[model samples]
Target: MKWAGEPLRPQDAPALVSKGLMLADSAPRGVVYLSVPLDDWPEPADDTAQALLLQRAVDGSPVVTPQTVETLVTALDRASDPALVLGPGADTEQGFQAAIALAERARLPVWVAPSAPRCPFPTRHRCHQGLLPTDAGSLAKILARYDTVVCFGAPVFRYHAPSTEDFFQPGTAVYAVTDDPDEAARAPFGRMFVGDASDALVRVSDAVTASDRPWPAPLTIAEADTSGPHFTAEAILDAVDRGTRDDDTVFSLEWTSAEMFRDRLTITRARSLFYSAAGGLGWGLPAAIGLKLGRPDRPVVCLLGDGSPHYTIAGLWTAARHKVPVTFVVCTNGKYRALEEFAEALDVPKGEYLHIPDLGILDIARGYGLEVHRAETLADLTEYLKKGPDAKGPRLVEILQR
Candidate 1:
């Protein structure tokens, strides 16, 4: 939360609420709480209160100065190899388009930041270099080739596994553009520009000289083999990608095989993919329902791990009751694969509780009023997803991964 306030009197209620709304709608938007006493709710409003309630908050993003734009343009033009790294903040409509324009104009390879909640650039673009690794050593090795690195709306780095290596190699110049002051301050080494990233991207794109350098190699994914009796995570993700190849399809993902999903699926449109930045489980089911509610014209496909359904099983009931047309794909390996992987990464013994051999996910979904299907092969999964556009209500497809 960025702000919190309490109203002591009836007259203060309107002002506090108005201020809270403004702060919540501002840059780096977040939650704001305004508490009011129960007695103040029924009080009569004065002219001042009425005026405050009628006020509207306009866009307050700071304008990028000419000198700041020149500094960035010079940095990009002087460097032999420059790259752009984006985070969830660049997922907005304006920011998405601006980032693409800047990357194309400056001939910079674009990489999504680690733990990104949204896709900032077109996944199929020629200049895209895929996602950055979450570990410091691997991430540093990838960025070491670039002479200049400009990060937009992302921190200098975010790590997952423990590492003793430095985040950047020596002689690598770094710059950042973000709306959050705290993110700018927390950066280990970088010249920070605190403002709307979209504004800065636009200004820099206009002033920067077009580079004559060759574009990086396009990303490629090997085809998944499906000759086996049981489906693999790669096969399931490939089926989902092929089933929803339309531009209007949106994906909500919280499955364990996130790296596989990133490699297998092609997301060419901005805001087409959503994930939980904080690594929260059970976000897939509810997020799919809400995304469908907001974007009624787009088809929403939710991918979840088998163990994640237990965390928010009631979301199926809500979807069924509301007749939301979201296709829930639960990849069932009959265990919490993420937990086991984490334990292995930490070089610890696996816990006895890691195995979930008795969970009946399909039965629970059907009990909650959803139509359920058990898919044992890629053909079965593909057939089910083909009917997603005409689905009248919520449906769950369980893909058995043995």
Candidate 2:
């Protein structure tokens, strides 16, 4: 075997690194924090210190801050209030708390401008309005009506001054708060405020009075289990919708669920969820495994595309080896639906060679000793998914898209 430093071939100096992971005692090239900011994250320069009162903005507290909480109390003491838009680039967790507090205090509607991910919430504080977007135009429309964007985790505005067509109604104030200086610096739309997101929220609570902007009501899905090729996607989604239990966690789409599954499945998200606004919730199979690992008692479901599952097929083996209980409900359309959509947009017929690998995911899952079920009809699919917990182990339910 080749020694650690030894070159594989002749005439070469000893290699300093192998496969990117460095040897012990080697300085870390960089640190990647999952969600929480790193303790060792480099301090900002003196010039950047103007944002924070202290010479150093060290605590990196994003979620809740004392100042924001105080602000919230003050706001609660009031009656009418301002419409709140938790803009991008703030400490999301603290911002979420602050938003919720403000909403409760005002006894009015509160909304997370762009997402529905459930994290950093006290288990009791899971109820809040997630914004609605039917299309690009709708997203812009909502952003337009608000006078101010109270950005916490995300930046205030994504404006292309080149075009006001997308801008929210002429001129709107965008204010931002976050623990991270980078977020404050990079916030494109609003005046940046630096502090714990919760603190910033508290500050907003202190400053603004309540407004009459109606908080979006909790999503009420009109469920229909219809049949036909025109309705297969909806039917399958209806089954997923009906089968979903509050105890079940869904990894909402990093995949291209929008192409086929979007209109069909009504996601009732309030708790135990992770989704992306980049519309990037991939048919997150491995992510589902990780979610299951973190919250083993909860049944994690990954609704993936045929293409997305291939990216992390190895994770299935890991699930089997560890006996991680997850149900991978693959929405198989036999073809790449996104690509097909593009084809239609370009007025191009799907090429004859637009073929997918013959991955019998059911057989593959069974090979790994997972309980695999394939449903041809809605009733069977619904029954299998609803009763998955009793299926003994990791389950993979395959439903044809027609």
Q: Which candidate achieves the best lDDT against the true structure?
A: 1
Best by TM-score: 1
Per-candidate clashes, comma-separated: 0, 29
Clashes of 2: 29
Which regions of candidate 2 deviate over 4 angstroms?
1-82, 86-98, 107-138, 157-164, 198-225, 229-234, 248-252, 259-271, 276-283, 342-358, 390-392
Q: Write the per-residue lDDT of candidate 1 for residues 256-328, one digit (tens) a residue.
A: 6555357477787778889887787888889999999999999999988888877898999999999999999
lDDT string, candidate 2, 1-402, tens digits: 111343233212212222222323221112222222343235343344233433332222335456554444443344233345443332244445555666554544344444433332322233334443433345566656554444554444433113325434555555555555664677545566565555566566555555444554543435564764433665666777567644444544544534323434433432345544344424377778888788776667777767777766878888888888788888776777666765775678898555575778888888877878877677777777777565445788887764
What are the lDDT scores of the predictions, listed in order?
0.84, 0.54
Model 1 misplaced stretches (Cα beyond 4 Å): 9-11, 34-47, 56-59
> Against the true structure, what is each candidate's TM-score?
0.93, 0.65
The deviation in Å at residue 253 for candidate 2 is: 3.1
Candidate 2: residue 209 lDDT (0-100): 56
